[model samples]
Target chain A: MEEGDRLHLGSATLRSRLIHGTGKFPSAELLAQAIAASEAEMITLAVRRLHLDGDRRSELEGLDLSRYHLLPNTAGARSAEEAIRLAHLARAAGLSDFIKVEVVGHEATLLPDPLATFEATSRLVAEGYTVLPYTSDDVALALRLAEAGAAAVMPGAAPIGSTLGVLNPHNIRLIIQECPVPVIVDAGLGSPSDALRVMEWGAAGVLVNTGIARAKDPVGMARAFAAAVEVGRLAHRAGLAGESGEARHGYGASSPTAGLPVG
Target chain B: MTVGDLEVEAALGPEQLRTRLRASRLYVVTDDLTPLEKLPDLVQAAVAGGADLVQLRRKREPWAELVELARSLQEICRRGGGIFLVNDHVDLALAAQADGVHLGQGDVAVQEARERLGDRPLIGLSTHTPDQALKAQLLPLDYIAAGPVRATPTKPDSVEVGFQQVTAAALVSRVPVVAIGGLDEGASAIEAGADLVAVVRAVCAAPDPRLAASKLRQEAAAATPWRWIRLNGEPRKSPPGETVLELLARLGVEPAGVAVEVDGRIVPRERLAAELVSEGSALEVVHFVGGG
Candidate 1:
């Protein structure tokens, strides 16, 4: 984790390679603990039902935003129009100009609506919104979002909140190869190994919620994720061992097994 | 649901929507209290503060203008994980792709609206007297609002239905009861059997609409239990309409060598996507742990 070589999204350069979601917590106090343990510099908050009177902080309030870049997400929008509107509202509410454009069209699978997401990205980018869209792991789609001026392109490893762990690594790799913007693998990641696997493939970062929040021990899970994300980045930088189809662990020629076995 | 080249996905189906409605408590219907331009911001704030279901009821705005506002408001609600409803216009609600529509006494009949809106969009009827409320119970309404519970300035001309009426509506209605009218100042509506309390100026006209809504909802009982199910023996809150395939996919379970038993019956690998889990459905997934 080179702090200087940070995860860049528009004007914000985040020190943390992993972004955490503020949802599904048993209590606001617990959520706070998980967030602190996660050590995530960027946190994703969905614009959902508010707790009026500000009596209950809804887990978002009281957080030290100075340490975190707020990435408000359009989680419920089923159309590009809906997504764009949510982005603007998020901006007006003083969350941030940076928005994670999520246009979910399928209820059953909760898959990203690729067409809606692309359209929203283009419009929001044109409107000067630092749009980071959550999209399907399609190379062409990633390029399109990048072309549309998205600050970063988020290709989900699996459906949001599913923690499926990189169902399509090939497409994700293709996105990394072609996408001009930084590729953040968002959603469907379940474990530290899953995070490491994507970082190994050169992903800019991973945004996770369910993998941490739903755990029996959320704070511990967050800490584990934080460590995993840090190591994953280091592993990517260090380079992995070379690969081959043949399985040979022992010294073959040194033992003279090839020519002197019969004697 | 295609608009130009873009595909607008349909709203939640009826069966899957039950879980959300059961959990939703506060319903905010936007009125003309705020300037037309500021309505969007107010709705956003109200939702941000905690209004569960937001209804767009722009009285004098043109259909086209209302359509645009509805789109924005609907998106805001959706982002907040709240339901968005359009008041008095089934066509507009359908056009804006809102969660559902709210019909009044003289507006389109509940049956007619249902026929056009089809099976998915929520249909809520606003009633005042006991007969209308009782009649509404006979229809296939997703939910019904019995209101003017204390009579407020928002709807000056409407008659008031005391808390007793709300209690009556709740008694006969099979669906959820939304106590509308002057509910901003009180919590007795919830005590009187109202699952949700709909408001206008109480939330929309507050100095900080978001904070006002939070305060208004302070004493309400918690919404109904979430549809929780066990996955691999651990409790998981299941969203409605979530198929076994999606659930398995989220749990990082590969279809190969993974056995899924939903409530004691094994759903073969081929039938995972077809099987939908309801509230309390027990899912036991046995996927061998390995690294290759």
Candidate 2:
């Protein structure tokens, strides 16, 4: 198994392509266990302002954060200004400059504001922040972000925490094919199969948060997703047979036709 | 030698001068209302009290006397680390070796000023509307002054453009927008995106010019006059004089794994702190992040 491939993001190179988000987890213990089980070298945590006098401990306090690269996200920001401010606050708190630019436009759906995301990405990039913008499955916007100097363009397969899996494989495929920077499938994914499907479609990687965090057996699901990503990447690299609309090619048997007794 | 080359020879490049202009919060324009003999004291006091730039606007003074005063004021500005500019007199600015000249709508064309002054000295034009500010972008201008933000006796014939024009002009201006006219405390103008707030009576008419300038500077600093730059491809505001490294730090961005580009060229990481982010600069800061 040729597993020597590395994920080059901005300046850091990682062996594992599975990126796990620390959101919607049932408990700190479970979240920690799931993270360990997933084997993801990079994990995202949302940057939120701590209360003035609140006794709340950070979600990252107990975890051995040295094992993973901390990618702070501007998850709740609704505008470019807010997202840029949040990225700064995240860095001010001693987190790395690696920022996930997520500007939510629609509240109920938590759909990313593509315009704001792009705006934040550009501003953050201008301020020397590594920006990964979470946008919709719009290929053009993805390319635009890449051109704007996004480290990687994360086009959501579906809405955040929706668990609907890849809704537009065609668009995702186009994004992966056209984008100069790495195209990561983020959001709208559920189950290990969904992760595998995108990885097989030539995505650099997949970001799974709710899919594993909300599962009944989160640790088990994390392990499954890790394996799926690896296998899918291998399949893509090995070169799967091309799909065809013609029945002869679509339903063709793998066995040699000429050597068969019936032939 | 070209005027720009002279400026460079003087160790103040156009970019450096523009950066200083953008960082300037208080600009004191001398008035004919103040006595000629008292002008030097007023300028020294204002500069001491935090005025970043002082303009000699003695419209009625004789050329020789104006030149003498301009030379003295230029000395005061240089010693105080403040910019000295002549109002409407390119020759006076040249004679005194002033930092720049501020032009009015009725003064010599900006093209003519640039030709005479060369690219070295800063050339600021006074604009009354957003249209004028937008048009100023086509000229070789270093900055544009907008407003009489309030009605004043200095320009009684001209209507007060208000803070609205200041905001509009700031939006349209590719150069730094200086909000002028009847300004006392400059918080409102700074909030409206004016890079520097120019005043006549606010400091000059005050019993204590230094205290008045200091108060206005404090007020302007509180509101923070943000310099506009295209980041990524979007218009964004940054604090004036913020270096590439400080910008990253202010945003809580780590220097590691980050690349900074200003205009179209990449700024090496080691030079981030030295490179000042000026107005109308296009910067692209990039770094890696955790993604799929």
Candidate 3:
């Protein structure tokens, strides 16, 4: 990455373009190792109601949570109200005011409800929370979310944990082009290549949860994703060559034809 | 609930509550005139219609009944993002886990309420005269309610302190002035320098309480005394008594990874709570934004 090429998200300047999620990992030790390997400055964590039994030490225990900027997500929320309530609960729990609004509309697909996400974003934004709404690859909705004061617009490449990878690149590209805020490609990414593809398409960053955590070698996959993110960001900033529909041979010969005797 | 519990639950600290009060335009005061069974729906409708503050004022109701009603109303206000206060009852406010208690002249002293409620809940005092309004400024109050802008049956014995008193109170008092009583439409009161307009019959007795509250809110908002300031290089009118922190909160912009400059001077993060945004003040707020 170029000097000063930091990911800025609502008062948080992050150096890493890869944001890792601490879910689906087999063990807390591995989760911590994967997090370290990923080098993600911001890690997303789901905020749920604490058990009444006072068992506060969940999988998040034994991990140095303070190391990364905690991005608490309303993952289990099925409506705008639930998402708003969860966001408040997260803030009340002393987590950062940065919230990743994910109002799951579909139980089977686990897809975010665009309207609910927008509602939560607008409400949370009005309440001084740095809102990042996880929405579908809907260009118009992404633009709307950005207009509603989302710190960043996270458009899902596909369903959460589906690993389909960039289902509608055209829509994602449109969102990135039209959105006033940074477009972060979140969810449904299978491999490091998917992360690279989105970053190369000028996405601000990529969030990998199941893609990395569920991998056979979670730590290795995290490292691979991290490297891909960095290189892709660098490539985007450096600019890529334009493509042509058809190859035009000898338009401007690379081998000097004028000086060659065979010419 | 204790103040600490309320803070954790509502996530609204005293400063945030004060900010909410300052920004409030329509305040709906519930009366015993409405049927007890329909009170929740009425309060909900009023809140949905943009009532920024809802005060439960049941003069004749028993303590037990009042507590139950207060708790329900508090939930409505909490969900609607409105401040819930109990009239003349600090204990009830505490019992209901209300945002605060609005004290009348005959009620508990402002200092006493503050001591009992602590610093978390807001304490608003109602003043009848200009002198009272001026004197109330020295007391520990979050907001000052002025007037019976016109006479009403709700408080038949109290003097009808007109719009002039609102102006007087607004001018003399440091905190936000709430113009109350006989106010159906609050444009005039807001124009008279009242930050918020509190109504009882205007909303509670309306056929459509939501519409009434909405209209009242609109009128007050239209005539609100705004302090013109340049925020992030754009000309904007902010509510009075808006500190830098309050401004940030109102805009939903957190202080983290952000820089605020007022009138060309960089305001440190710690001073944001103290730095007041005065009229014509040029404020430049820059926040980072790029996250996955």
Candidate 4:
């Protein structure tokens, strides 16, 4: 299919293959520009402080809000109830039903609470919200989230905004290989190469914020990330050689598309 | 911007833009004539009149003054249940922490702006022609304003893009088009495919800006009617003669957990198949969800 073709996941059918982040940009305008440059169909935003329309410090104040799904993140919630409450706040504020469930109990690791995330996803999904939980690279945890009616599973590469890239490719591969829903490599992606690497491994998408927002040239970096994601997705569709079998003395350009390891 | 203390309660962040953006019908653009002190009052009036999206379009104001005004206006828009936007000046927008900014062709490049502002703020553009609108469709703008549908003295030098231009832009553009310039409180603009009708003089010039905005909102509604009833308070469209059971099936809602309420009365789950609903019938499909 062409790049403009619709990407169906659960209820949404988006055009772009990439998912961008709204956090960490210097200004809302810059974030908007990067998202446009990235051509990402969906963007993630944190759910915190109730923004009053005229509040100067509120980041939600000046958005143009036209296209794309606004996936609200439960970034500060320490438990499932707190996450769900914030989810409700997001919805009451006129956000869509889709949410990115991020239940972080530990401040040091900033890692998601597996139990909290699973609990939150179930409730949100039961409320008819499309839940995409951000979790560690645990295959079993990923399976549980998917079973709990998560629209998609988002596994971190390392930590949130760490720019560490994928910490464990093996688990990511397993999650993508087994999960019924789309698998997204979220957080800790530092560069276009990191995004391309994950996509090459058959991830449905990759979410990057710090990588693009903190880059020296955010706009240029945004464009580069967009190209990398496109090329990576295209490469995956075309077929890439995997480490499935023992290599012969010589090598061909690529392996057969059959065992390319798509779920 | 320094990282906000994550624990500190924040204004609803960027994700809420989608719903607010979609629900907004009238976007009131402020003009130079409105006094600095009165701008907040004018915005309040507009919001009272149902101006859900308001923009501060002052180009000649000092940066500090602009930022200061954005603070008060943002609060007013928030209290009024509307969004506040800056016209041009992305830097001032960032400093004031406004919701978004509207940039035209000669303003800051969208990419350059992206370097300064993050993605959460609303970023929109003004397009006068079909080509500009179509090209902008590829950009990361939330909405695009097309036309001076009727030639107005507001910016006499500005080219007038008739209703046909609005139609063309709407047909090709992926984002919402706010038909601007010379738009009166009428269904004409909305009927011509304008997602919103932005007026400056009509509301600003009016002695009662609130009443003027309300009239425009009524016209915009008449032009474009809602297609679906609220299902569980969310918009859902049901086909003619669609039974409650079918909608649940179509929505993929598990019947076991679903409870139906059409209009104001409850319809037992067993009798869901017998109930018929059309376009306007309200639906409250509640279900018991796990977790807190």
Best by DockQ: 2
For each candidate, the DockQ is 0.01, 0.04, 0.02, 0.02
- lDDT against the true structure, per candidate, is 0.77, 0.83, 0.82, 0.77
Model 1 agreement with the true structure over B1-292: per-residue lDDT tens digits: 6657755545566776667887777888887767778888888888888888999887778888889888888877776777899999998988998889999989999999999998888999988876787688667678889888877887889878788888777645657788888777436777676778888888887788899888766655543322556555543445456798886665455665345667756576788889997777877654211000
lDDT string for model 4 (B1-292, tens) is 2235423223447778756787778999998887888998899999999997899988787777888899888877876678888888887788878888889988998777766888888888888887887788667777888888888877889878798887777655556678888887757877677778899999999989999999999889777532345565544434445687876775565555334667756576678889886656777654221110
Root-mean-square deviation of Cα positions for candidate 3 versus the true structure, in angstroms: 19.0
TM value for model 1: 0.47
Top TM-score hit: 2
Better of 1 and 2 by TM-score: 2
Candidate 3, residue B66: the lDDT equals 88
By TM-score, the better pick of 2 and 4 is: 2
lDDT of 1 at B185: 48
lDDT of 3 by residue, A1-263 (tens): 68899989988999998988888888878888888898888888775433211233556664666677888888889999888866765664434789999999999998889888999999999999999999999999998998899999999998998888999989988898788899999999999999898898799999999998889999999999999999889888876643233433335545766766663
Q: What is the TM-score of chain B alone in each candidate?
A: 0.71, 0.77, 0.76, 0.73
Give the lDDT of residue A9 in candidate 3: 96
Return the lDDT, model 3, position A31.
84
State the lDDT of candidate 2 residue by residue for B1-292, as single tens digits. Answer: 2354333124367788878887888899987788898999999999999999999987877899999999889878877778989999899999998999999999999999999998889999999987888788789988899988889988888899899988888655667789998888879999887888899999999999999999999998888567788765655556567788886775566676455667756576778889998978987665432222
Candidate 3 on B1-292: residue-level lDDT in tens?
3454463245487788887787789999987778887889999999999999998888877889989989988887887788899999889999998998999888888999899999888888988898898788678888899988889888898888799898777655567888998988878888777888999999999999999999989888887485757665544546577688987775565675455667756677788999988987987664321112
Which CAPRI category fits model 4? incorrect
Model 2 complex DockQ against the native: 0.04
